[model samples]
Target: MAQINLQNVNKSFGPGVPLAVNDLTLTIEDGEFLVLLGPSGCGKTTTLRMIAGLERQTTGDIRIGERVVNDLRPGDRDIAFVFQFYALYPHLSVRDNIAFPLKAQNLPTEEVNRRVMDVAERLRITHILKSNPGRLPGGEQQRVALGRAMVRQPQAFLMDEPLTNLDASLRADMRVELKHLQHTLGTTMVYVTHDQIEAMSMSHRIAVMDRGVLQQVDTPLNIYRHPQTLFVATFIGSPPMNIVHGRMVGARFVAGDGQFWVELPPAARQYTQHDKRVSFGIRAEDITVGAPGGAGMAGNVVVREPLGDETVYVVSVAGKTLTAKTPPRIRFNPGENVSVKLDPAAIHLFDGDSGRALLPEGWSKHV
Candidate 1:
């Protein structure tokens, strides 16, 4: 069992260049699955490489279990790195590809064969052991790569978007397989992916990053329901959270365009200033749209998109575009006026200039 820790880690391409990872500090418990999730060039992969000894940090300490391994080489790190592409030799058979790492270590021939067949059996690829890499399907090729990684019994696994090359259906299938594999092996895993669905489905906890900075770290449910920053609130959702520029006025939220207003309880005043500029945020699913002249904002539907699972409507409320998600069976044509009601408890308030969640201490109960 191995626990990985990174403390005040920083990396840069050159002396005068900007940092790739800035003051990153994180800890992964032994046998835990930690996912580094972010978009391209956000430094997630770089952080994984630093842990695997493939890249050096400008300043920090990387500890594997109880030992500092900053100067160690990749091979000596006791961690297996899985690439996005299948790195198998085209001429080698599946069994040979799985056994190559053991052979390189000069283990006994019988031992190498035993480990290879064992991993093949575990991966359910024993029937294709003799097939060449080029002859295998994409899913089977990935299994071969994983078999190779598993045969080593490394302290941890660092995967850099290993399912990126597969089709959508195959990628989803592999996600289930990979999660089960991690559970069975109980090895420390630092997985890198930009796909939120993959991260949400597989990780025990997610580390969200953006532009070389850590945004928030939490469970998938918490990340979805209670985003702490504007960036995270906007990035984590599919239709994205609707944020309207507004101000708090005597128990009322008035929009910047003077279109409509929302009644706020007097108790919420402590969370906002009098007529202070603020951002009002609510998820698409939390808003209900219907006929006008009710307890909500009156708006005209600009467009309706049917997504089978649900219908998304773009509504013009006081000249501001707000997206609302409705039931799949609900039908609305463009130019239809609708009343939009936001779940009172679901509303989010963010500071206008800093874009930070405005929550009173002990705010969990309210949320």
Candidate 2:
């Protein structure tokens, strides 16, 4: 396995176009599963392509192992790229498709057969080895594509949303299988996806990007619990984080419109600047919904969405709508009054103007 590194990488199409990737510097440890995660047009795919040697960067160095590979051909990069679509050859049998790379390398017939069978067996696609890829199901075709990549035994695997074409249930199954496969193989992998769930569930670490800028890189849990930027705060969660426009008044956070206030926790007080504009953030799961006129801000439920295991409540509080994710048992109807309590300990603070997290020193110790 090899470690991949991109130092101060920048990609630009031309003078008129914006840089696709800007000053991106990141390192993927040997045998680590690192995911490039962001929404569309966020330069994630471009970054992946650059690492694969498919697109050359306009600036900076690209290193795989100990080699500077900026000018290397894709085939010479020692990386296997799994495209979003199952790019299996329609006319080739699954077995032949898996053995294609070995054939290109002029490996012995016996060695190619052995490698193909091994990968097929590991991927559990041996039963379909003789089947033509054109007749296979989407998931099976995907396996064929993955098997083809795996049969090569490349130094690293770069995947671009490889599960996007599968159905939701199949995608979930593949996520588990992929993670297991990565663990078993212990090869370096760089996966690109806009699906936060995929990134959160599969990656050892995630590099979040926005508008060509590298926002943050950390473990899935750390990125979720302690986002370093406003975009990350709202982007990584399912229901997203609930943010309130406000400013710090001493140790208290007062809403911009002067509707409500929350006392900052003592641990966070040292980081707060009196009269500084900031955004108060809390996850939907962190907001507690209680009986009306209880020990919190009173709000009227505007909408109730039942999501089987849990119910999402959209409450109108202080002229702002905040979503609360509560247990299905804690039912609340629209138009009903409820008390919404923001957990003081779970709150996140960000600079209102710059949209950057305002975290106290040693904050990672808590995460």
Clashing residue pairs in all predictions, respectively, total: 0, 0
lDDT of 2 by residue, 137-189 (tens): 89999999999999999999999999999999999999999999999999999
Whole-model lDDT, candidate 1? 0.88
- Give one digit per residue, the lDDT tens place, for model 1 in 151-179: 99998999999999999999999999999
lDDT of 1 at 367: 40
Model 2 sits at a Cα RMSD from the real structure of 1.7
lDDT of each: 0.88, 0.93
Candidate 1 regions with alpha-carbon error over 4 angstroms: 265-268, 360-367
Clashes of 1: 0
> Could you tell me which residue pairs clash in candidate 1?
none
